[model samples]
Target: MAKTDQAKADKKRQQDKERQRAKRQRDAEKNSSLGIREYRVTLSQTEADALTDLCAYRGGVEPYGAAEFIATLIRRDKQRMEDEKAHLGTCDFCGEPLPTGCKNGLGIPRLKGVEKCFYTRDEKKLRL
Candidate 1:
């Protein structure tokens, strides 16, 4: 059954909230691992006024409510860089296309006159 417009909108908002929470958790973990902590600072009268004006200028979305946006941006940028590297054709020495099965690894797939892709070296031995 098709969802109503309001239902779809509510679902989207819920998803966005979940994603934001996840990002915040990840960033908080990273900070905690580094023995760091986050703190809120009190702004001066002028600064607070400027911040209030800035927040108001932001249409629809609340600026201070943008939790973990910076972390999400960083994650996306790293993914994009990795994808670019993956698309750079096969290895010249081995004549193998890059592997796309998983993330955080650089194992390339080799034709090597075999029926299917094979690795010259065992992935477990290799440092991913």
Candidate 2:
């Protein structure tokens, strides 16, 4: 009886160690770039279907499926923003070099959701 109890205890310990090891592996993978996460967004059924369809259009911009395509598209947009900074707008109140430069007169007049540009103290004082 004593021997059987000891064996059961050993088995439980081994199982626990294996579970911990697997958990660590999962955590490491999540921290890596290739890790996966859940993202929720609202869309009409038609839009959802369109997105699923678009995923097949390319050989898949990435190694994964539709999620990767969405990620790639987001990355592409951000890259385009940085690369095409000349097209951005500047802050009217601050006169700072806006993200993508200014558009229209006085450069957008300070938008709520727009990315702001960096301007020197002198630029702010210019009143331009």
Candidate 3:
């Protein structure tokens, strides 16, 4: 009876380990498919302390960790930039009205194979 009980316990432990290994493998595959890359950031003692304090202050039922807080900040900044660009209602590159249609919408300069309107300061004059 003792040997049987021990065998059952060992089998259950082995099954649990196998289950955990499978879960980790699945997680790794999912992350790879999503193109998620992990980065290691080193912070000074003061910075780490500040981050901890900020997280604690912002904590409620669910607290924000340092990574979550930083990601949120980045997302907010990106949205703000997009909003500002749209509000301008002009081609970012040529500084002309977007209705005229510029090569690149975001004002980013294309180095190779520059379009005719790329250097044209006044697209309206160029058309006439």
> What's model 2's overall lDDT?
0.64
lDDT of each: 0.57, 0.64, 0.69
Pairs of colliding residues, candidate 3: 92-107, 93-107
Model 3: lDDT to the true structure: 0.69
Candidate 3 positional error at 47, Å: 1.1
Residue range 14-104, candidate 2, lDDT tens digits = 9999999999888878768666666898989999888877777764554347677789888888787666555535556455455423433
Kindly report which residue pairs in candidate 1 clash with one another: none
User: Model 3, residue 49: displacement in angstroms?
Assistant: 1.1
Q: Candidate 1: lDDT of 18?
A: 100
lDDT of 1 by residue, 1-128 (tens): 35688899999999999999999999999999999766576779997777666555652375633234434545778887687656645544445444433222444343344333233333232223
Clashes of 2: 6
Which segments of candidate 3 are over 4 A away from where they belong? 1-25, 89-128
lDDT of 3 by residue, 20-75 (tens): 99999998999999997667999999999998887777766677898888787778
Who wins the TM-score comparison? 3
Q: Give the clash total for candidate 3.
A: 2
Q: What is the lDDT of residue 6 in candidate 2?
A: 100
Least accurate 10 contiguous residues by lDDT in model 1:
118-127
- How far residue 63's Cα lies from its native spot in candidate 1, in Å, is 21
